[model samples]
Target: MDGLSGQGPAAADRADTAIRAIGLIKDFGDTRAVDGVSLAVPRGTIYGLLGPNGAGKTTTLRMLLGIIDPSSGSRVVLGHDRPIDAAPQIGYLPEERGLYPAMHCREAIAFMGALRGLSLPEGRRRADALLAEHGLGEWARKPIRTLSKGMAQTVQLLGTIVHQPRLIVLDEPFSGLDAINQARLEEMIRTKAREGATVIFSTHVIAHAERLCERIAIIAKGKVAFEGAVDDARAKLRPIVRLRTRNADGPWRSAIPAGTRTSGRDWEFELPESGPEPLLRALIDGGAGIETLAIERPGLHDAFVAIAGDAAAAAMKQEVPQ
Candidate 1:
């Protein structure tokens, strides 16, 4: 099981959900930060809270971690009705990165673990091992001030998981990371999940969520625009069809749907629900000179555009809060 428990079947089943939020809402003074967001994160899986900047991803994460109380609604983490009661079993990395510049890298990690009730000596031991395993062994005694932004972020991430919490919540963990460090962080996330940790992370980059999460919740304007398996998200839109034709105006043009448009030498449209066999047969029978034809699967970005529209799509490019 994902949790460190010896409960029976029924209890184990109850523990299957690492986190659940129902109708969550958070209002900051006059501004409503999050509204009516719900999510069920399965145990031992990588769950992504995906949204553009200022779309409530951070707020929702805060609510889940009990860092902030919701204006209304409820949340459960690690089977605790109150998320705060489950804090010992959770590891959280906030969106804003912070570390004492004077603190050594290993001590910083150990200090974080100590905050979660781990003994300092054990925390330090785990910290040293984690840094070394992630190729930061040489920097063990170095102060946080010496590390680059990416390295500092890495040090903090190592701290987040040093206690090995059952539920790890990271708000935009990919931020401030270079490509190489991003790849390393991804590998670490996968390693933790394989060890039966339930990892929930927020990210505006659809590509990170695309590559890492088994399930994702797409938030837009403080609400969940879509939620389900990543594959389901990709399945929202039909396959795309791209064709290169020798003749643009011909009887075979009838096989092309009305919405199909010409792009350079290619004709592009959504593959009809009935399947491409009929369309291909029609084009062939009509003697359309087909130079090339490609059927493409929709990615998470395309599905986001389909579900949340263009405004939500624009958030994917934003790095700051809304």
Candidate 2:
């Protein structure tokens, strides 16, 4: 049942959405940071919130956590109507991670759990389990200041989830970790999703979105530029299959033979909606001496660049009004 509760037959529909925001708006004096943004995060999925810095990602997350009041609009986390009401059921790891560096790893993790409404002994028990799970048991007694960035990150992660919250909001959780730790973090995120906890994280790393999230929202210039299944977002950009040959000098470069265009390295482009067979046949008949062939499907990064770029261009045009 995903450990989430709601009421009535509508409960089923509501349970699917662990977090929902409608007409969410936050203003800082004259500047509108979040402008009428509506979002839904399905239960037990790792949803990625991606955007460039100052695109209102932080502001929006703060609103979700009830850290700051919205100028307008409303949000619901789990079944809670307000952020403070949801605090005990929600775990958050902020972008700017800070801890009592002087405190030992175990104590630090336990302390955070206590703040989340866990008892002292219960917090210590959860901390031990988490540290052991993260392969940091050996350093559990060491002061946080003595641990490396990766080690400390593992502790921070443990602290955030120790109370077994139903929803977690992590901001740049992988920012300082190395490749090994990043992989570990990814694994942990997956395990959380499997345990029926809805996980929403904000990250600049597109690879994380590609690897972990079932769906992603790319927020740009204070708005959601793209949101949906990863494959769907990629499909939005269309598909292009590229053919490369040792010989760049070929007739294929000129006259693309309809529905196709030459890119580089004897490459050809085609939209998936049209299928690939026609494009493949054209390249074969071109007699371009194909040494290698590859299909270039749109990726998350491509979609992000496309949407973010368009938003920036639009903003610029508005600024240049006569």
Candidate 3:
């Protein structure tokens, strides 16, 4: 089984969900950061919490990790009611970067593992192995300040998993990474999931979620705007049809859906509930010389815009790094 419906370790072993949250809410002073947000993450799968800046992604993650108490609601992590109870089994990389620049690369990783109850010797052994596996063996003794930004970030990530946690949570981990480093991180995430660890991450970058998430929850303005598999979200919107023909007007015009628009020799519109067959037949029967007809499925970005609305989606896009 994967871990979602069960309560304890035995039950979790019999189920497929690893983490489950119900009606989670967080309040600070007067502002409600998270409003009744609930989600279930399947065991051994990658789940994404997607939203724009200040959209409550981080707050929700924090609440789940037991880093902060929620104003209301409940959560189960690794089959335990208290996330802190399962601390040794969870690996987390917060949005903020905090590694001692004065510490050696291997010592830094070993220290992080040691905090999770790993013995110093064992932590150092694991750190050395991890650094070597990630192609940084030569720099294991060098200070963190001496490494490049990407290298430092890589070392920090290695530290996160040094103890081999069953669940990994990363918040905006891609921030400030170049394309190469981002790709490397994506590979690491996949590797963790493939090894039977449940992974949950929060990001404003829809592209990352779209590419890596098996299940995603789109949080907008402190609420869940949409949640499900990527394909299911896209299915909520109609497919688009693009037509290019010699005749843009006349009886052929009738074939275009009522809400569709036409410009010169090009036409574009959503496929109606009746399906594209009717429209195709209408165009052909009207004697319009068909030059090109293409149907395109809605992508995740399009689905995000549809569910989260233009304003929120635009804001998210703006917040994404260039």
Models 1 onward score TM values of 0.92, 0.86, 0.92
Which pairs clash in the backbone of model 2? none
Q: 155, model 1: CA deviation in Å? A: 0.5
Cα displacement (Å) at residue 173, model 1: 1.1
Q: Residue 18, candidate 1: how far off, in angstroms?
A: 0.7
C-alpha lDDT of candidate 3 relative to the true structure: 0.90
| Model with the higher TM-score, candidate 1 or 2 | 1
| RMSD list, candidates in order | 3.2, 5.5, 2.8
Tell me which residue pairs clash in candidate 1.
54-322
lDDT of 3 at 65: 93
Candidates in order have lDDT scores of: 0.89, 0.80, 0.90
Give candidate 2 regions above 4 Å deviation: 1-10, 245-265, 285-290, 310-322
Residue lDDT tens for model 3, 1-322:
3344535665754256788888999999999999999888989999999989999999999999999999999998987889999899999999998899999999999999998999999999999998888777998899999988888889899999999999999999999899999999999999999999999999999999989999999999899998778889999999999889987577877767787777888888998789878888888999788999999999999999999999998999898877
Deviation (Å) of 295 in candidate 1: 0.7
Question: Which stretches of model 3 miss by more than 4 angstroms?
Answer: 1-14
Backbone N/Cα/C clashes per model: 1, 0, 5
lDDT of 1 by residue, 13-112 (tens): 4567888889999999999999999889999999998888889999899888888899999887888878889999888999889999999999999999
lDDT of 2 at 290: 72
